[model samples]
Target: MMKTTSIIASLLILSATTFAQSWTVDKVHSRLGYGVTHMGISESEGSFKDYTAKITSSKEDFSDAVVELTANVASINTENEQRDGHLKSPDFFDAAKYPTLTFKSTSFKKVGDKQYKVTGDLTLHGVTKPVTLDVVLNGTTTNPMSKKTVAGFKITGTIKRADFGVAAGMPTAMLGDEVAIRANTEFIKD
Candidate 1:
């Protein structure tokens, strides 16, 4: 009985260690973007040029994971230099003061086979609010060159600029309050 107990305990420890893992974001294959309606007639799209994401999980399927991301507000690009500058000014993100926008996942719930509902606190313009994102686990594979496990995910969500105190000169009639957020991220197991 004693020998059997020792064997079971060793197996349990190995299983626990095998399940827990850490992943590092591969910026080369990741993109974070946002879109907003302009003048209720057109839509403008932009992307952040600098960001980082770290994820930790213990589940084999990544059902239990903690995710954190941060983006540089000053790196906002909208294809137009002038507009991009304006977005970084005090009227919008106030990049000079709050230079970084961050998100930290509080909970992750599996809604489908590869779909998840991720609820987290998003901090923008110095204000934090709860946001839920629909996330899809694209897939996981082993990198041929790096010999590391890689995973891909697509996430989508929406947030109100006014809620985060980002409504400076952006009036409702001129600019939409809701901003659509989308991200395609790849991670390498570390």
Candidate 2:
């Protein structure tokens, strides 16, 4: 009886795994970038150099999917070393204390033919807040060499730095409060 139960359990696990499609972020072909107004004159853009993302879904349309991601806070680069260092300090991201920023989706709702409203909890600088992103499915294709199915997406959102406890002493005239986020990512079926 014990052997029979174990065999049944194994089959159940295998069946569940077979039905859920898993996708891993193709980091080399993906980017999570951010832009903000600097000095009320120009926009400063940057991107995290290291990050990881995973997606699991049971629906072909991906409306029932779940997405999770983590970005290394220390990987921030803005084309200026001094400014990058400042962003890593306690006054900013506090990279030494909080080395990673993370997000986990609570819901993925289809809004249009290829558009979605993704609501998730974003944690940064020791703070967690609920935010919604406008996401567009850029379609999917199969790689010739690996023959793996690849999916593309464009996600856009905004978060106030002060709300995430990332506010420094910079005046409003010097820096904008809202950080505009834009990410273009490709995921490969695993």
Candidate 3:
């Protein structure tokens, strides 16, 4: 009876350790940013100061990973106080009403040696829509200080602001309809 119980416990431990590894964003080494053309001339850029993201995978190559992220709209920063305030108002994100934007991956498919196509539902400005993003796995390594496994990725995509009812009255000549999204993220195994 003792030997049988030991065998069962070992199996359970092995299964748990081998499947469903969870990774969390290392906030200090990650950034979520966006860019939009201003007045059809120069590009305006901004970034969210607060966000949370997680990745889950059972495969070593992260070919079958699922990613989910949430960012606080109020944390938008463009280094300009007035513009940031306006973005938080009803004209744009309406941070008071929406509070946050989110993304949850529906499909994560490996497209190349270190590239992936991630399709997910993005909820922003009180609207939910499907969006696809390209992800490039920079690499994975062990952190010298913590001795923990860490993975780096870069994600890029573009979304139409009008589709999500963000700044519906804004014209393309003033603020470009397409917002370019980019994020450089580092995830630590948990």
Best by TM-score: 3
Candidate 2 — worst ten consecutive residues by lDDT sum? 165-174
Q: Best by lDDT, which number?
A: 3
Candidate 3 C-alpha error for residue 169, in Å = 0.8
Predicted candidate 1 versus true structure: per-residue lDDT over 64-113, tens digit per residue: 88999999999999999999998898888899999999999999889999
lDDT of 2 by residue, 1-190 (tens): 9999999999998887788998999989998999989999999999999899999987778898899999999999998999999999987889999999999999999999989999999999999999999999999999998999999999999999888878567776888999999999999998
TM-score of each: 0.90, 0.90, 0.91
Clashes of each: 0, 0, 0
Off by over 4 Å in 3: 1-18
Evaluated at residue 66, the lDDT of candidate 3 is: 92
Candidate 1 C-alpha error for residue 112, in Å: 0.3
Q: Roughly what TM-score does model 2 have, to 2 decimal places?
A: 0.90
lDDT of 3 by residue, 71-165 (tens): 99999999999999999999999999999999999999999999999999999999999999999999999999999999999999999999999
Error at 118, model 3, angstroms: 0.4
Name the runs in model 2 displaced over 4 angstroms.
1-17
lDDT of each: 0.92, 0.92, 0.96
